[model samples]
Structures are given as structure tokens and as C-alpha cells.
Target: MKFSCVAAVALASAACGSGDGAHADPDLGVESSDTGALLAHADPEASGSCQLPDGPRTVHQMKGPLEDLQGDCVPTWTQEELNAGFTRIRDERMITLPENPGFERRIPWLAADNGCEERAQAASYYLTNWDYTTPYYARVLVKPNKRLILKTDNEPGGSVRWTHHVAPVVRVDGRLMILDPAVEPEKPLPIEEWLPRFSVAGEVDVALCRDHAIGDGCFAAAPVAPSPPQIGDKAAGLHLRLTAEWGVQEILGRDPHRVLGDCPPWVECEAEPTPDENRPPTIRHFRTDRLESEVFFPIYVIGDNFVEGVTTVRVTGNGVDEIALIDSSTMRSILLASWYDPGEYQVTAANGAHVSQPVVMKISEF
Candidate 1:
């Protein structure tokens, strides 16, 4: 169950300290120490290649109440903010490096223990380095202990520390993406998937970008030219701490009410993402919760006489034109549930003797 491509080794250590001697103390927090092991996926041995553990394949060990059952008021953006963010990125005003073609998750200076500290540190670094070119950036509030997929501690109503987090979100590739240079460092994940990891009660994103040319002012979150954290200082004492109240949001000096308490009426609340469509290949109609197979979710390519027609096959529109031709068909298609982000593609099948319609296979992001 190595979700996504289990390729590169994850860095298990980070450097976290403020120039003001905030991390000089050994008792800073639980998530600051390497041996404390906040994220089990982070390698305990600093010298070891940072690979995920081979147990039950889940993203993170920590879990909180799902959004529906939650009883907290999370602060989120108004429609105006979303619109501005979209506009800023589309204008190509955010920072970028040729190395970053997007889809990355490596924070070079963060360890497993430096959750909130990494947020603080990375925000400080980006604010300093990209000050000139940054059209818009924000000290975004995030839901603590948010996992990309659901696999958990398996305890009900236990002492789950539902903490709030502070991270940087920058407009990238004409969309706002989370630049969480700590936990999932450098991974410019889509805002839609990243936002769900923030406080469910609510989130008030603090604007951090300033157009220096126009002399626009920006909120002062960290030093104007702070140095980035390195290995030793970054992973020392930045462990996560449990709290009954808003944690990182308060630590980052944001208004706690923006994350918890009364909900301000707004129309920007987005609907949940639609799951991948499970269209029965045999017919035009597709249905959800269908009892297709015993394997739970089976990716089907239903069609009449799929074995007869076989030709120049390859998966198209997948960034790369992967020429994987399906020579012989045992059944209709191979199970595709295990493939990550296997959506938005066409299977170019060739007709042998008879002319038939090309079987187009679309895998949605369920």
C-alpha cells in the first residue's frame, strides 16, 4: 500500500530555530525531538535513507475526527480571497525555480518533530528570499494532523490533540498551492487537497505578500531577512504539542477566533470533490457503490468483445505519452484501483479486422 510513487527517500531530520534563541531550550515541545518520533514515516536514524515504514500503508499515524463529525469552527477564506489568489498566480507573480515543475514534497531542513516550527521557519525563509518577486503569499492556517488518506490510530474519542497549524501557501502555476516546506516539504500540492488538512472549525488566512515596487505593506509574521534553518538547529526542539485549544494558530500570533468560535456567513464554502467516476464499460451508464467485485473498488473497462479488437495502445494525456499496449485481454481490463492519480487519460486501442469505436478509458480522481 505505498500510496503514490514510493520512489525518493524522505528526509527524517530538520533544522528549526529562531535567531532569537526560541529553540535553545530542550523542553520546547514533543514534536521537536527526533527520537520522539512524531511522524513514523520519518527515518529515526539520521544517516539512514528517509523511507516510509512498511507497516499498514497510511500517510500519517495521527488522525482526528472527520469533517462531518467535527464540532469546531474552522476559519477559511472568503470567495474574494480565493479570487485574488487565483488571479495572482495566473499573472505569474509568484516565485518559481526551474527545478520545480511542481509535485514535490521534500523539506531539506525539517525533521519529523518540527511540525509547527517548520511552518514558522519555512514561512520566514520564503518571505525573506522571495520578497521582491512574490505578488501574493500568506501565513495560512492548517488543520493539524491532517493525512492525505484515511488510516489512523484506531482509537475512538481518545485524547486526540486537534491542533491548528501555520504554513505558507503561495500561488503557483495559475493556482494557489500549499508550500508546506516542512512535513511534505516543497510539495506544491493543489489547494483543494491541502486545505482539507487545516482546521475544520474555520481558518482565516493572513495575507503575507507585499508588492515592494508599489510599496504595499505586508503583515509582519517573521524577520524580513532571516536565514533558512539547517539540519542541527531545525530538528532539535520543534516537536508538536497537544492542546485543547487552537494550537499553532495561536502560536503564530493569529486571531484564534478566525480558527474557532462563531462562523461568519460566507458563500465561498466549496463542495467536496467528486469521486472518480466508475462507468461500466459495457454501457454508457456508470453507478457508485456498485457491487462489481470482491476486491471492494475494481477499475473496470467494460465493452463488448474486448478481445477481438487490439491495436496501437498507449495511455495518452498523462504528461508523458506512455506507450503501454494491451496485447491480449483476459477479461475486459486490468484492475486500476491501485494506480495513483490515474485519471484523465485515453486508452488508444486498435481494431484488428472490424472497424470499431476506440475504447476510451477515463480514470477520475475519486
Candidate 2:
């Protein structure tokens, strides 16, 4: 079922790519033309609307092995990298358009009235865009009977409750840290520090869903089916879903709340955007044309917010191969020549000024 919110509780606090010259060949299983269907342009008409999908939800497994969340497939970062990411994503909060304060072109981080899922997703989007690895969602889910409550000044009653709460999580030096700017704007919090904000911390179960696991497969071994809401139950299951079926669309199509209905009477603050508003492109997911790693095939890089005409793709590690922009909307095509040696390499996208976190791609006939 859709998450529920209550106006109770006391003082708790808180909170692109390029392409190659590969064509749309279904037999090859690579479609450069399909990126348009995936692109979710900003909705100017429904700017401030914060409507989430209705009904029961399903939490699917991620694309990579579970070890990725533990830093096996994902890269770990230093504390300095963590600070840089915190600054970049937190600064993207939507603010100040005299006519419609929420009309600003950024995530509405400052307003915590509702839309935790959207805030988490948008924060993850910006994190991956800032040269960091794809961050997963660290969700706290409780049995149907109990509600997860938090004390915060942002809400009208100085508190808010939900069936579940989520935030972007990243791997830093072997630890998973929560990046919830709305709750803890000053810095990133380790999972240990994050759990205390909610009243029912001991009652909820936590789950991690990678940003790429849009559909089923990653958690097939132990899946959480959506259940009807009940009260006072103590089941270790969570009803969760990625919200959006594809990448980028999660942020754009969802139309996260730009302005909270119960926002405190604060003036329309001026948009204090950072000097570099143009974010670097991201590499959300990528795959080779063929299943066999030994064979030479074109690689497809799918992502969002790519800067057209300027974005470029490249692979490095065992070998170096550059790719041309195939479709600027949200995908890139890389034509790997047969002569290049085959081995595991990191694939990344760049928009001249910024480079995205790398996704692993192997081109060997193993």
C-alpha cells in the first residue's frame, strides 16, 4: 500500500550520457532509439504537486550481486569524497521563484512536509551525478501495525509518522552512510547515527535497494511482498518498490513535492545555487550487446540528465576505448573495435566539466 503520514509526534528532528554509432537492432538486443521513452522531462505544469503512486508496492531485487552494497562491486570512498558529495547534493534543494517558490529547478530538500521517497531518489540521482558510485536506498520498514515516527520542526505539528522512511545510502571506506539532507543537513550519517531519529527504530527492519534494481531479479532469494496495512503487527517484511520503473524517470516523472502544504511561514528565500549548477552526467546502468564476454560487441550506457552535444563516453582499466554520442536524451552507444584487448574495464560518461561514477563492463571472451 502507499506510505501513510500522520501529523503527530513531538520534537524529533530531522530531515547523463553519450553514445556510439550502433543502430536499433532488436536481434542485437541494443536500442539506442529507446532512450527517449526513458527520458522524464521536468513538468512545468504540475510543478509543486507531490503525488506518489497509489496502492500496494513491490520491492524488487537489484541488478548486481548483493555484495555490491558491501563494496564488492561498488567502489568505496574516503571521508573527503563523502563531504564533497554531501555539499553537492544538499545544495540542490528547491527554493525561491517569487511567484512559486517551489518552481526552482532542484530537489525540494528544505521542505520535509512529505515525499521522503522522492527526496531520497533525487538525492541519489545527484550523488551518482557527482562522480560517486550509485547509492542504494536504506529503507526502514515496520510491520503493518506500528508507525515509524520522527520529531521534526519542518512538519506542522513538529513531527511526522510513516509506515516507512528512506534515504540515499552510500559505501564509504566499508561503511554504509545515509545521505538524508532534510533530516541531517550538516553531514552524512552512518547507518548507526541514522536509525535513532525515528521513534520505532527497534521495531523496524532495514533493507537496501540499489538504484539500478528497477525491476525483479536482485532479491529473488528473499523478496518482500506488499501486504495490506494492519495495526500492531510485528512482521519483518516491508512493502517497498523503486517507485519509477526506469532510471531518471524516478525523479522527473514522480513530480516530487516542490512546496509542502504545511510549510512554516518562511519567506521565499532567494535561490542560493552553487557556482556549478551544471551537474556532470551519470552512468546509471550499462550492458554489452552480447552475453558472451569473449566476443566483441557494442556496449550501451543508460542514464539521465545528460548534456547533449558535449557528453562523451569512455572505458578504462585493462584497455582504453572512447565512444561517441549515440542519443543525447538518456543513452550512449559504444562501438568497441575487435582489436582492443578484452578485460574488465570501468565505463564512465562525462559532460566536459564533470565525469560520472563508473559502471563495470567486461569485454573478454571468457
Candidate 3:
């Protein structure tokens, strides 16, 4: 089922690439090329949309050993239990919700039959039903396969729309913290109130944010910038450099200890070169006219060191036919580039026309 307005707004903000032995083979397994097909067949009625497919509703459920249990499954709670349970966890221990003045105060409810106890229960139902969990500090970990839906009222200037997005949460003080890419890309939601509204299906672990350091659990697993390149001996008449950057943390918390090997004594820290930096000697040109009329920019990354991905080129004004990726070193255009080292890159059409951003090839080197 789809998320309510609150959850939709919450998730929209939290929000990656590579190259060839160039082995241009794509990791089609992780790639959601078929997601479009699955979405096409998805039940819209489940999300309160008229265009939904007719089928058994796919309720979001947690996987793993703790899937069936609820809230640690304690039979009895003493004073200590009451103190330690989510009820006593200070607001400071979780991520805060965003305040959007533009957001409509009243939202349509799909499952009014299951009226939530409060906003927190509403939020919980959205998350838990979708197999998403918001632990203590509004820190949420979304499974890659999950899709969030948001259906708008069909009125003038209102059309039912859906988007796939993600957001990460952090906790500070007695409030919830959020790092949402859609609302505040760089800035974080340092403080906000979390109202529990939904009944969770399984054992949802809500920890006190005070238990962990700020920005420790959530974004820490995200990809980090690689170190600066080290000058190595030149070879084959081409400059050979060795650079080290950090990749995505293994997310051991998501997997079982037996499956993922023993948890590291301390979080593992390793570095390697990024994909774009490892481009082959030959240069090629790749261009797309998808965002022909809009002002768009190409985002590329070298390592975590840079702020915005390298803005190779910017298309200004309107009606621009194509954008190309060229080699700065050789002044040659790269028609088809491969990406092996996974990172985030995009060509955004600010004007919003044809928003088709296809995955380029991925290449790896020995």
C-alpha cells in the first residue's frame, strides 16, 4: 500500500555508479529495470488510486528472524520496562518531522477502517505496512525493493502522482532529525516532533537517540568520499594514479550475523578508487536529448571530497537538443561511458519535460 501525506513528505527527502575492465556488464540483479513492469501491475486500489491493478494487496512485511514478533515480545513490563519502552524515549532520541506550510492539513485516508490511535500510529502504520521502520531517532532504513506511493486528490491542480524516494533520519537532543534530499538537500531537519499513529505488524525496535552519537547510525552507512589520488609511476605513456575513496558501508545491521560474517569490532573502514576516476585511456561520447528544452546539469562524482558531482556541462535556457560527456584531458567526447564503482549521478531537467535518465554502462578494472 501507499504512504499517507505525512509519510510521503517524510520519505521524499532521504535519497548513487561505476565502469568497465573495462567489464561493461551491468549488475542487472540490483537494477530495477523490471520495476516499471511490476509497478504497472501493482494494485492502485491498494494505494487508494483508481489506476491500481486488481490483485491481492501486497502488504509490506519485515523479513528476517524477528519478522513475526512484535515490540521485542516481552510478556510483562515492570517499571523498568515502562521507562525503557518507546513511550519514555525522549523526543530528542529520534528524528523530527518536517513542517511544510504548503502541506494540506487534511489528507485522504485509504485505510480509515484502521484509524490510527494518533499521528504517530498513522506514521507507524505507513512505515510498518511498507516494511519500513523508524527506530528511535526518526532514523529509517528503507529496503531497496520497496516502493512508496502517494495518491493526490483528483481536483483542479491536483492529480494523483507517485514517486519512489528515500530519506535518512538522525536524532538529536529529545527531537527527531532528518536529512531529506527533496525538501532540504544540504541542510538537515535537526528538530521536529514525531507523533505515533500506526500499529506496527512486527517487532519494531525503537532505540533512544541518546544511545548513539549524532549522525552515527544512519548516514554513516552511506558512501564516503575517496582520498586524494596518489602519484604513481607513469606507465604505457599514460598518467597512472592511485586514489582511495570509501564506498557504501556493508549495512551489517540489515543482514544476519551468520550471513554477513561476525560483526566488525569497529565499523569497517576501507577505501578504493572511484569509477569515473578509473576511466580507460580511450575517450568516447555519450549524449541524450531527453531534457531537450529544459535547463539541466550533468552530475558526476570523483569521490566524496567534492560537494556537487562534477558539473561537466550546464544547459541553459530552453530547447537545447543534447548534452554530451567529453574528456577534459583529451578534448574528446565520451559517447558511451561505463560505471563500475557505484555512486550517484544525474542529469536533471530543471524545466521538467521528458525526465528519462537511463543507466549508462558500468565498467570495472583489475
Question: Can you write out model 3's per-residue Cα lDDT over 1-366, one digit (the tens) per residue?
Answer: 211112211111111000001211111011123233222221122223223213211112111222221222111222332233322221111221123223221111111111111222232323323333332223222233432222222111122111111223322332244433222222344423221111121222222221111112211111111111111222200011000000001111111121112222223434333323223222111222111111113222121211112323322222332443433211122121322232223332211232223333222122
Estimated TM-score for each candidate: 0.26, 0.40, 0.18
Better of 1 and 3 by lDDT: 1
Q: Rate the local accuracy (lDDT) of all candidates.
A: 0.29, 0.44, 0.22
Candidate maximizing lDDT:
2
Tens-digit lDDT string for candidate 2 (214-303): 211122211122112111121110101111111122212111232222221233544423222267766655444212223344444555
Query: Cα lDDT of model 3 overall?
Result: 0.22
lDDT of 2: 0.44
Among these predicted structures, which one has the highest TM-score? 2
The TM-score of candidate 1 is 0.26
Which run of 10 residues does model 3 get worst, by summed lDDT? 237-246
lDDT order, best first, reads: 2, 1, 3
Comparing 1 and 2 by TM-score, which wins?
2
- Better candidate by TM-score, 2 or 3: 2
Instruction: Specify the poorest-scoring 10-residue window by lDDT in model 2.
Output: 236-245
